[model samples]
Target: MEQLFSHGISDSISDSIPQQLYRPEQVRHMEAEAAARAGVDMWTLMQRAGAAGWTCLEQHASAEDQIAVLCGPGNNGGDGYIVAALAKEAGWQVRLFASAEPKTTDAQRALQQWLDADGEVEPLLDWPESEPDWIVDALLGTGIDSDLRGDIRECVEGVNEAKLSVLALDIPTGLHGDTGCALGDAIIADHTVTFVAVKRGLCTGAATAYRGKLWFADLGIQREFRLLTEPAAWHLQQDQLGQWLSPRPAHSHKGQHGHVLIVGGSQGMAGAVRLAGTAALRAGAGKVTVICEPGQEFLVGQQAELMVLGLEPEDPRVAELIEQATVFAMGPGLGRQDWGQRWWNWYLQGLERSDPQLELPTVLDADALNWLAESALELSSRNHWVLTPHPGEASRLLDCDGSDIEANRWLAAQTLQEQFGGVVVLKGAGSLICGSEGTAVSPFGCAAMASAGMGDVLTGMISALMGQAGALNITTEDSVRAAVMAHGLAGEAAAQALRPGTSRGLLASDLFPWIVHWINPNDS
Candidate 1:
């Protein structure tokens, strides 16, 4: 049966937006320049921002509900003042709390306007008596260069204690727009209305926990801003998948799709190779072969579509098979035992000594990665290979602690790419695929893919795509990016369809049909 789950964007919304993502600093300057270019004053843009924020609040809050708008010392506080006045005019019980007076001209003007409109501004030193239905966090914007201390921290603590549904303006106060690190104390918002462009920080790590249900408000300047500054990064949108996917030719045959060879699965590990080989076939590999332990020949043969190659535990024929195949996937379920280690070493030596004339696209994962890391192989020079390492493996390869790798995932991926050269897929919640040019992150996959054997399936899928596309002359980097996106999308589909908390039951084998379904859903 074909898998029904795959991640994709609707046709209508796919082509409308560009994938350009910016750093917080770049976005702020871009917003200012864009506002100017639009013949709108900066204050006018701030007003629109506040209005947008108020509109968001109205959408989520009831008309009679009491709300507190927390303001800081800068323009972010100015936005709070505007929201407070808007809420007051709308007949809602609203109170404005600020740690310090507004300092910027637009902020001062906004404060005067709020006071003129009979809005009450109170110091946030003491907690409000009555708990409100909502809290507007405008304490800090993207300009937070220093840590949050003194009254701001106290204010944040009070808001948390109030147990109100906090809606942060622009960004959650205290999140470094560039690093996504919290500045001492930060507000945990239920919803955040970011302007212009989404900051990269919000999509990764602890930031994802704080910024809930993120909404992007262009504030009517995205286009102008995009023209002025190049995006440092971008989020993967669903619609762009088709562009990277290979279109089938009317007269195309199995041979045209290219062949994939999977080399792994030591004794008692046949399931990993089976998952990978079947995944390759499902991913549209014209031919799939699994070179596993001779003891597991029957297990590999159970999959009718996959060709089982019964090789001795440490056969040199494995290298020959690699030479003949269009792509190779190694390390899934590969044990570190004496037999497995000997096979691994032979495979490595074969790869190193292979005819320079025969360069096949390869994927190295699991034990393959561990062996290479332990051996200190110069991986960067092997441009034909792709390394898929989860955080632990990546830490081992980089000779760093796992926590260090998790602390700065983006930089870690970048460092891996710089050091290792080939496309590196740093798999985790927000899986990052980094190449020489730049990095792309897929925030789509869920905890469902955390189950056993998922990585093995990913290895095969990537290998297959590389093989299929490389035969057509697609760049290795582009192929890796597309494969990573597709793999995550399939995992997301499985997560959505299966029972909650049952992701552990989602075998890597289940993703193959979903991959096909996603690439061409309407097909028979």
Candidate 2:
């Protein structure tokens, strides 16, 4: 029987996971040369990739289990054929389906090898009539940039419709290796075994769902390939916490940890500001001040530690708080009403008038972002700020549709960072952070984070982290990436605590305790 649980890439392979990600074209251009330099031929590399994929399959399948391999016309198909030949030798029932005869010499040789192994091939006009334990997707490789068409599209659809466990070779068929977008449709694999370096496209965007439980095999070419190429982005991992955050000094006082000012919380939406303020405190900000709309002081300050000042947009106290704040996190519960607008203008004007050298780090989110999208005010690159925008808010900031942002999250993130300066945290599943240091992708976060006010908590976490960036002896980019990973991990932890192994009905505030736990990386 097939394994019921996901045993993600084994520990031995886990250590080999590549942090540096390359674009698909870069991987393609360098792989052949790298393989040759590593004293391996293309066929030899193909055999290594097939062997790694078979190992993953072995983890899922028992002896004599049925397996179906869908081979394409290219080298990706060659990988599928090699896996089929191995399964056949291992005493498994193998049914290989080909969309067309192998197109490349390497693939053709692989097809002949499968034939030599006594493996029969069938046309992939439809999914195999006999339901198999697993489907191997090798229909398309990383070169795909447009929508899938004709028989291949049908084949991809059939694989998805069949709803069998799928082990995708390289990338799930129909996913654009550079953009992570589905070409018309893509195979939704339960496990994806990718070769060489992890592709940048597989790290973000719509590819998140299609590429499940990603496993990588360097195929003995990573060192050579890495030497010849520059990473498109670095993958963010939980282990980065220790590298980015240090334990507070034992003699630390509230004044030393930095103050985080949360400027928002208009009217009935005090919960948003409250969440942000509380999260800031929980994340180890020494002091948290909320300059909320007048009459919201009680609601925003319900958390006793928060210094809540209900001040009008024009209040002098607001300026005082701004001057004292180590970092400003704007936008939570900042509605688009006149009150919100006044506060937005007030904050920007204060920044404009302040000495450029003393520019406070700011994080803009929610309605604050919406206001920025609508504003004609020019923001120079010198402004030290981080913009945290969900896809919808990002669409506004970029003047594109949300679908467009989701279609290419990496592009959207880079564009935002280039335009906005400081850093850009494009929040969502597999959030992308583009900062002055470069781009990074956070693989944390789960479905439970889809609820409301989640972004608010993230805003506070980012702000709190930024406040301590100096003491942590890290850059603003480092703080932002760490906060993103922590936020996602906290969300996952909260969901698990609510109901182990499930992600549902998790409130944003539920992340508070987990936030405390993750923020203190040295504690664990």
Candidate 3:
């Protein structure tokens, strides 16, 4: 086997895994699953991993160029040894640097294979005459703890300083595959050729920055691995939305799509609810009503699709609208003052009318969450609601610092769900959706969504989905998840509209057409 592979990376590789994302422990366990299956073993998987990395390198680097291979003590490092030997055979200048001796038996066997191929492993103390054109980071993979220290820390720093293009084998060394958080300092790769399933962390937050262009190669265990375990979190894709969407027949009417009552857009903040209402229309809401302060009705009137109704806080129509509403999208422009405060109190106070079976699926956003946080209530009753809050709002709701909320977004989402019943969409770089079903993290989105009215747009989108899904008797979490996926894709499309270098000026309205594309499968 060693003699046959000494010629360099061959085209004999496995299928690609683009959809499924896994936690570190999950992927490791799946490796065992793959090894346990017939005609494959741990060493075979490791060799395939090495070949995968080598193929990625050949695609990115010149054949005549020098390559710096950083190897560790674990099987991750063993993969490095094989990659080094393969690169050398492929006729590149392969300079192998070893931080430690091979630890596990499989790693030991892989090390011997490199020696048989006459490849030498050098210590970092010795410097090569010329800098390598590419660096292969095979050190310290997913198994490492949060504390990135000792020789590994120094090695990571060296790689980052070299600032050269790097191809990280499964994940960039020092990045917690489970959390995608950099445990201290991590390698910044130009591209990461990951094996098996994708580590969930690579799709969001700080971990996302280090992995430049991610490509996946499943190593022939895609089906077996999937059969062995479920994913920790789903990376939302456009395709997933199709199952969640119920097609409307030619006989379908506007009343059947479900009505959406968006309650907010207080005085001086009318555009907030307008954006939400527009988003609901784009998301296939049969009818959207924007109920705001008396002077704010004109704000929603600009959009001819939305029906704007202005009312005083104590108006009888408030309860009437709530009764007639299919779903309520609350808190887009809701302020904490008298006008916004009164309406919030009305919704909270009025929710008591419905039993759980007939309760409205409400999307609680912006100041509605603030009102909840300020009320000192445990939210013991509102089981049919979705709270969408950014990190700052999440901090307020959870009573923790914003930093704590940002530290572990999934944990924050779970804590919020525990505190406030119903779905909690912890919106940010990687927005998390936590509910009774489980948690789903939004994998696609841009920093562009950080602009002023983005959340308002999402509020409308998800609420419309929830209302529409209610007509079809679909699950609330499913509707919410689909909305999040659609919003993210829309945001990405809006961002792409800008010139290549810049990611600015993407407005909430820019996502309207894209939302239509996501909702309608035929259009997509």
Clashing residue pair totals per candidate (backbone < 3 A): 1, 0, 0
Q: Over 4 Å off in model 2, which ranges?
A: 1-16, 351-358
TM-score of each: 0.89, 0.95, 0.92
Question: Which candidate, 1 or 2, has the higher lDDT?
Answer: 2
Best to worst by TM-score, what's the order?
2, 3, 1
Q: What is candidate 2's TM-score against the reference?
A: 0.95
Candidate 1, superposed: residue stretches over 4 Å from native: 1-18, 125-128, 145-147, 157-163, 310-316, 351-354, 377-380, 470-473, 500-507, 521-524
Of the candidates shown, which would achieve the greatest lDDT relative to the real structure?
A: 2
Weakest lDDT window of 10 consecutive positions for candidate 2 = 2-11
What is the alpha-carbon RMSD of candidate 3 to the true structure? 2.8
Candidate 1 backbone collisions, by pair = 380-420
Candidate 1 local lDDT, 1-524, one digit each (tens): 11111112100111123466678888866778898887778787677777778877887898888798889889988888888887887788988888888899999988887888787778786446546788999989988878888888888877777667988998999887765667776788998887778787776666776787777777677778888988776677666566667467688888877788877778888888888888787777899988877678898779988888777645667656766788877888777876568767776666667655236777889998899898766433567778999999999999999988876777888888888777899888767788876877776666667788888888877887887784555777777777777888888787667775555667666677678876553345
Give the alpha carbon lDDT tens digit for every residue of 1-524 in model 2.
21111122221133345679889999889899998898889987777777778888888777666788999999999989888887887788889999999999989988888888777889897456857889888888998888899999988888788888999988999999988889899999998888988998888878989998898888767788988988999998778897888788789888877899888899989999999999889988999988888888888877999999887877766666777888888899999888899988876676667654247788899999898887734765644889999999999988999999988899999998888788999988789999878899998889988998999999999999888888889988898899999999999999998898776788999999999889888874
The best candidate by TM-score is 2
Cα lDDT of all candidates, in order? 0.77, 0.85, 0.80
For candidate 1, give the lDDT.
Answer: 0.77
Candidate 1 displacement at residue 279 in angstroms:
1.8
Q: Which stretches of candidate 3 lie over 4 Å from their true place?
A: 4-19, 125-130, 351-358, 470-473
